[model samples]
Target: MSGRLQMALSSNMAGESRNLGNGHNTNAASPLKIFGHAKSKIRQVFKNIDEYVTESDRFLSGVPAEERIVDAMQIENVKAYRGKIRGIIDVLNRDHMKVAFFGRTSNGKSTVINAMLRDKILPSGIGHTTICFVCVEGTDEPEGYLLQEGSDDRKQIGDVQKLGSALSSTKASEDSMIRINWPKDKCNLLKDDVILVDSPGIDVHPNTDVWIDKFCMDADVFVLVSNAESTLMQTEKNFFHKVSERLSKPNIFILNNRWDASASEPEYAEQVKRQHLERDIDFLANELKVCSKTEAEDRVFFVSAKEALISRSPHTSTPTSVLAEGYQARLFEFADFERKFEECISKSAVKTKFEQHTVRGKSISSELMAVLDNVFERAIHMKAEKYSTRKEHADKLDYVDRQLDMMTKDIKSKIYEMTEEVERTVSSALNEEIRRLSLLVDEFDRPFLPDRVNMDNYKKGLHAYVEKSLGRNLQSRCSKALTITVEEESRQMTEKMVALLPEEQKQNTLNFLPRRDFEIAYKLDCRNLCADFHEDLEFRFSYGITALVNRFMGPKQASMILGRGFVQNIPRSMPMTPQTPTNEAHRTMGSDDNEVLLALLATFSSLYSRTTVGALAVTGLVAKAAGWRILALSGAIYGLLYLYERLLWTNKAKERKFKHQYVKYASSKLKLIVDLTGANCSHQVQQELSTTFTQLCQQVDLSKADLQEEIKKLNKEIGKLEEIGAQSKSLRNKASYIDSELNSFILTYLKQKD
Candidate 1:
């Protein structure tokens, strides 16, 4: 820590406290002292906020228990609020601060970091440089490095020479970011806390804005580096001005680098420094509205980063201290600026951050409560009312039962018709797709294993080409065909189901039909059918691509090849069972995310090559006995593989024999997906209809006694929550009071004019 900060911290007088209805008198305290007091009180108040979030997260793990109980948005709101509250917990636990450096090209941002670290850790240069963001975190060790970028795994580097090459854009992977675990004892400013982020220059690169966007969520303080040679320009002002919309202007620091250059003529240096500082003060005061000119004067820092670096370098003859030897004039300027920078960061309020998080939590919680109340009024109330008038709604429920029966029959009929249509469409499209891919394969007339080039080089290029070719073939011919078939079938299925639905009938007496229950059940059935159809559709798509790749490439070659694009992306396993306890209609959910598709693909791709090699080796004796010729078609994907089983499995001399094999293979996989998918869809539909229809009948069968008993349970839970709310109201009142104190502290201390 710097001398001034340490002195200020030591001078922070601990005050006597007496609680006066959650609003203590903090009259004699300075702003920083008030911050310490208020933060403690605020943390205590947020404990209740924590409990509220924990309880809600547990109760609403995957809420509504049944979809009939609440709408999708209501369930979604609960999860959203739970996430926001958890975010508040994260904010409250943050014991460290993060600072970022942003400026135009060659503004000495990296040099500033190097000077601060007291080591040449970052690469500093002129012109447009620094292609990626580098985040340096304080560490206890000498030095450790994490080199991260692109799809490559993070490489840990301890060697200083290796780290140098990793930092360069051309030498390193694209989007490489260096995470240096810099020793805390080496740097005074970032000793026990600050995580400094250095970004690429703002206006030079084409992707400068995109690279900067990644830091928007993390940056707490921005040190805007400006050259001492120039005044604050429009682009620099505009950059800070745009950022001030999101980040508070008061937290910004103006760092003027290369101050030693201006000091060549000592007489002119003071005038030059004042001119730059004055312009910057005006920009921050008027344009950014951060502060008035007088308040902003001390915020602009002019420093000689080069001089500081020279003083710190091991080869330098000058002593380490700025005042020692002949270095007083050159390096002392950097030391004074560094002290002020440390002071500015040390004074930033802890509560100013938590206040935003608290507000976010409160907003989310309020929205969730509103959603819950609305759901209670609509669904829960109607269920209770329907129970009271059960005797009158008997005929209405009977009519609903008949309609459900008709809906089941119509759905079964439509599904079969659609499957037949899909079969017919797939065969024609599949044949054409096979022809298209086969032509491309035939055109590649190179030796299966090239005689000239090495095997490793041939294997890598060939695998990429095949994966690319299959990807293009899948998108253009295979998946598009499946997409079209699914759309037509789905449209026809919806039309038939809608035609089968019964119209609502008027009742003579004052009665309420279980309309909500029936609608929920019907939608659930519709949802299940669509889910099954889509899963089966994707499975068929994957199977078709596998078959196409198998036919032209041969099963031996196809098994060894990795399929990366389109239909070759093996479809995710159909979630026939509910993953969550609350959502009993798990089978009723359809996901386009293909949640586990990539993981399965990665596993299968690796295993595909190994397993085929193993299987072919085991069957080598059989191929030798049958005198099987090596297939020349599979040179493109993976290097080479041989399948001896094919020698006896298909007789190319007989057309009927070849046709039987293709027909058998295609029919078996398609039928397997259809059978499994249809069974899951049909079973879920029956189970869901039985469960939901029983619920509707029970609601229609409820006696007044049953209704009264449920109301008692409902009111009891409500009363408990209301009691908790009262306590919450008191704590929030305390939070509000302390928040007011913090605002007062800011106004009373920070904003006071000189």
Candidate 2:
């Protein structure tokens, strides 16, 4: 056989060779026949090799393979070429990988990255410095700018000056998101194959959490930086737990910074470091320790980012000297960084294999596939059953909605009634208070002045007395003018009270109390009659009668004296009456005077009795109105509760729909995988099938994994829906119970009144 054919056949012997040694020797055959047989076998081998090479070349057409090495020496290189080709094919078809750096505020995360890159591009401080995610990749130009959301336009930042000013400015709004790009020339550390992302610092500020959550979800590798002083704090632990659960890819690297500071006492620091590493391994399973590049002693480089930037500029080389002194330390750090980087890259390759197994074919072994299929079928059956449960929940929610609708209407009606009742009560109370005030004033005047005088004259005398008293007091106190102007001040206090009601209540009584003339009046009447008699032994007795009439009426004035301290004292002066002398003969003729005295007392008693009764009636009406106000407030609360219930129901419905879609998509994907892998066929053709079948099987496994994931998601959604459904039912039942109790109380109150 030719050399090429021999090599191809020998290389494929393990995978494709078949034995034909039984009674197949042909040494006795003719020389021409032997040559012909060998030629035919060689042709067959060449055809196979040509086909395999063509297929491989087609698959890896655009993939870069310069970095890939098939063998260490020339002897095994030919034999290993096919295997190398297969590996390349697998890698070329795999998904792109990503890594993220995240941690608590002031953890020196940025500094560690600077140490890795041997330069600083990210901001670091005790307070919040990083505000948004910064994606860094190898580039040729040193450029940085901000990318606003919903726009393709980028705002160019000329230098660190703009970036620093933007970060430090008080006017920086929420819309400010920045992307910094620096060239390898500016910072040699940035030249690397891996993409590095510096996410907004987590747990530093409330606003940054949102950005971290979104960025971390898509991360393939998460490098968590924890400070030596507070390694694995509650927030850090919680964050790691969440990340592990959400992003199941196993590429996680934990770096403990500020180890030097923590290691002040060598033994203690070493113990603390070991303890931290053990704790992290327990929690995360992958962790590392590194001294913070920003603060290190004894061959430790304290990177001054400002100095590094200055060195890069053409104006001066001052920063160059500072960096040169620490070059040896930086070199050591870079060596360590290179080792870590290589380790991470190797782990990424393994992860790629895992991903390929998941997506390219059915990764589950035959026994595992059978078990999983059984489990999946059972899950499908469970989901079918859940349809009924979901329907039941939906029906319950619909019933609740209907009940809420009825409740809302009932509450609205009660509110209207309560509002009207409150208005009536307030009006009655105000009128009663006004009437009480008027009667008190009338009683006061009756005792002080029995005869009616011109109102103008009376007011003039009252004003003169008040002015003289006020003038004296003011003169004693200060040198200010005593301006006493007693103009009648009338207020529609009932109208003001009504205005305080809710807008809905105000609208309900629009007709009764129009906006332009919204006032209610209370009427009060006062009549005074006085009689005086005097008896003397020497003269006939004489009696004189004086009568005064006044009327006071206006809107309720309770508010006018609401906060004022008055009506605590009653005047004691008696009314003035004309006097007459009495004699022995006059004593016998005193019947007329006696009759006058009796009439005057009867009038006063009647007036007082009527006024007291009116005040009591008004008080009772106001109390009833207050009861209505309470009912209205309760109705408003019920309305708000109903709205909340509806929102919850809507969210539950959305979750159900999402779960259904996820299930359907997963099922179809699994079916396609099973068909491609030919997992349910006879075993006769299995041997003839190439690794293509295995690869396809791995793909099927990925689809099944996706299906399992969907199922898990569905289960989670179902649990949430169940929780909300139960909560809603409980709330509704409680509300109904409360309504029943309130109704019972109202019934009792009304019956008592009856």
Candidate 3:
């Protein structure tokens, strides 16, 4: 073989004092072990916070809409907090120390990761070998497996060649990643929970932002593997700049790989190494400002990854080739790089990974406490307001009750007094109408042609006519006055009662009784009340003379004695009889013609004393001279008296006596029923006014009942709000305690230095 081929062939023979299995030296004394403990505690704390958020959301959602202090939007914000807390819990569960490598193509980026593992796990070549991001982490399984993004099936990684071929043959975007799970027992770095990620060349992919967001966001440290023969490229530097923008003070390391190429130029080996160191340190310390210059010196390294990888192989041979001159020294440098990287990654990952979680946990707890506190305070305020409003409603209900009670008494008293007044008015009017009963009987033009056979029917007609006329007259006089008085009082009472109702109910017409015209019906019927009435139709001397005078002197002179002024005219005709006694007796008779007829009959006895003797002597002399007989004259007189007495006098006496008896009977009957008719009218008025008052009372009572029910509901709501306030206060206190514990315990541990 040639000398270059022999150098490559003899690289497996190199061995050193250090073992590759203890690459990170992650024992009990290691910082990574302490960080892992802290990480576990942080995950538990986040899990508790996640549960708190979920419980808070459930509690807030169950509150009644009327009783809720927080609106819908704020409650939704709490639910959003639940989602954020769950996201934090998921991140905490999968947390690991990650280190991503970035560089131009063929800068030995994959070779650097393989050397760290002390095995060629990642594909490395002279061109762009890494087609997509490849992540290598530890798994507890005995067999290794691979998982590509967007798929769940595991592919067995039997060997590096097969894994490399699988990665090379895959059609994946530059941003997509392949997860490689190697047995943790084989690599100390993987055993310490270190995940190494190798990316496609920075110069090959333009989507560095996507790559950083998708894969590098959780990375604890970034390694920039550069070719030792060239200067640091801008494409490689820009990737870190973008990374620093997303992460605060990201941990970065510079690896000057392929340093063995400088062996051919021995004269400038020191100069080239010095130049690469200065430029890389300036890029990190001055340009990025991620760390100071002293910190940057420890972060940069010059090593040969190929030589380091070959030196770690399980072989024992001494190679003496030209290219293998400084292999042992390069292997030492790689070991030193691993030691420093372990320390840096352990401390940095603890702060970068868990620090953010702690900070977010503190913020979420504080915000939750604030939300609970706000809810508690709002509940307290609402509870107080409800109590005050309930008190107002209760007071209003009591006031209305009192007003209704007093108004009921006042209205009832007014109705009683008005009913009495109606009774009195009806009684007085009925008495006045009864006193005019004779004129009413006279006005009956219903053709009462009385005879012996039709006497009963005539009496019935007269009785009905008097009853109807008296009832109509009494109703006309009494109804208007009583109606006016009762309506005015009822209207006033109605207005007072309506005022006691609720504001909304006051205008509702259906809630109250409608107004109607007030009236008391008068239905007096005296059809069969009188049964002992008798008319005097026997032959009387007075009726015979009155009929004879009417027949001889014409009907006009007789009507003067029988008409409405007959009693006054009778006193003038009987001048010789004591006038004062006769007028006094006539006045006592009162609308009856019996006393006048008796006086006239007594006066007719005197006509036969002195005046009739002289008239008979002259009449006897005239009859002898006219050749007429005394018997003929006597027969003519007898015939005239018989005709007048049987025909006109008997009928007139029967008709007049019938009227007089009917008037007397009707007057007595009307007087007897006056109190009863007045009482009925009064009772009717009482019923109307009482019913209106009763309805008004019902309306007031209904309003009072409704107000009382509302007060009860308000009291219930106040109690509910009180319970809600107490629970919210307790939750706020608990959340505040958790926030303090997170700040004092978890944050202090995450921020501690290695």
Query: What lDDT does each candidate get?
Result: 0.52, 0.40, 0.75
> Which candidate wins on TM-score?
3
Candidate number with greatest lDDT: 3
**Worst ten in a row by lDDT for model 3:** 1-10
- For residues 154-225, write the lDDT of model 3, one tens digit per residue: 986643334443245544566778889999987777877899999888998689899889888878899989
Higher TM-score: candidate 1 or 2? 1
Comparing 2 with 3 on lDDT, the higher-scoring candidate is: 3
Give the TM-score of each candidate.
0.40, 0.30, 0.48
Per-residue C-alpha lDDT of model 2 across residues 26-142, encoded as one tens digit per residue: 232221222223233333333333344443333222111321211123213322444543454444333233567777876766666654444455565565566555555555765
Q: Pull out the clashing pairs in model 3.
A: none
**Segments in model 2 whose C-alpha atoms lie over 4 Å from true places:** 1-97, 140-149, 154-167, 170-177, 184-192, 206-213, 262-268, 286-334, 353-754
Alpha-carbon RMSD of each model: 34.1, 42.5, 23.7
Best-to-worst ranking by TM-score: 3, 1, 2
